[model samples]
Target: MPTVDFTLRWPDGRQQRCTSPSTVIHEHFVDGQEMPVPELVARMRVAMHAASERVRARYGFACTGAAEQLEQIEAVAARYGGDAGPVTVVAVGKPAVPEVPRAS
Candidate 1:
C-alpha cells in the first residue's frame, strides 16, 4: 500500500501536516488548490474512509492514521463556524508512483 503525506494551510494561516495510509488522497485533492473548510472536511471524510477500507482490504485492519487525519481536519474546521473559509493545499510529500508498463 502507498502512503501519502499532505500539507494544508488552515484558515489562520497555520500549516498542518497530515498523512493517509493509502493513495486515495490524490483522488480527492491536489497541491495548490483551495477548498472551503466544510468541503475540505467532507473530502477528508470520504478519502479517509476509502483509505481505511484499502488498509483493511490489504492488512485486515483499518488505518489509524486515516482516523487521526480526519480528526485533525475536523478540529481545524471547528475553529471556523458556519461559512468557514477555504484552506490551501500546500504540498504532497509523496505522490502516487506511475506504474511501469510491462513488455508484451
Candidate 2:
C-alpha cells in the first residue's frame, strides 16, 4: 500500500497536513482546487473509509492513522460555520513507494 500526504488551506488561512494509508485520496482531492466545507468533509469521509478499507484488505487491519486524520479534519471543519467559504487543496504529496527486492 502507498501512503500519501495532502495539504489543505482552510478558509481561515491555516494550512493542514493530512495523511492517508492508501492512494484513494487522489480520487477525492485535486491540487489547487477549492472545495466547500461540507463537501470537503463528505468527500474526506468517503476517502478515508476507502483508504482504511484498502489497508484492512492488505494488512488484515484497518488504518488507525487515516481515521485519526479524518477526525482532525472534521474537528477543524466544524469550527467553520455553515456560511464559511471553501477550503483550498494546496498540494497532494506524491505517494511513497516501497522498495521491491529483485530476484537474485
lDDT of each: 0.86, 0.92
Instruction: Please tell me which predicted candidate would have the highest lDDT against the true structure.
Output: 2
Which one wins on TM-score? 2
Structural similarity to truth (TM-score) of each candidate: 0.84, 0.90
Any idea what lDDT model 2 has?
Answer: 0.92
User: Which pairs of residues collide in model 2?
Assistant: none
The 10 consecutive residues of candidate 1 with the worst lDDT sum are: 91-100
Candidate 2 deviant stretches above 4 angstroms: 98-104
Per-residue lDDT tens digits of candidate 1, residues 1-104? 87888999987789998888888888888889898888888888999999999999999999898898899789878998656567999986685465899999
Candidate 2, after superposition: displacement of residue 89 in Å?
0.8
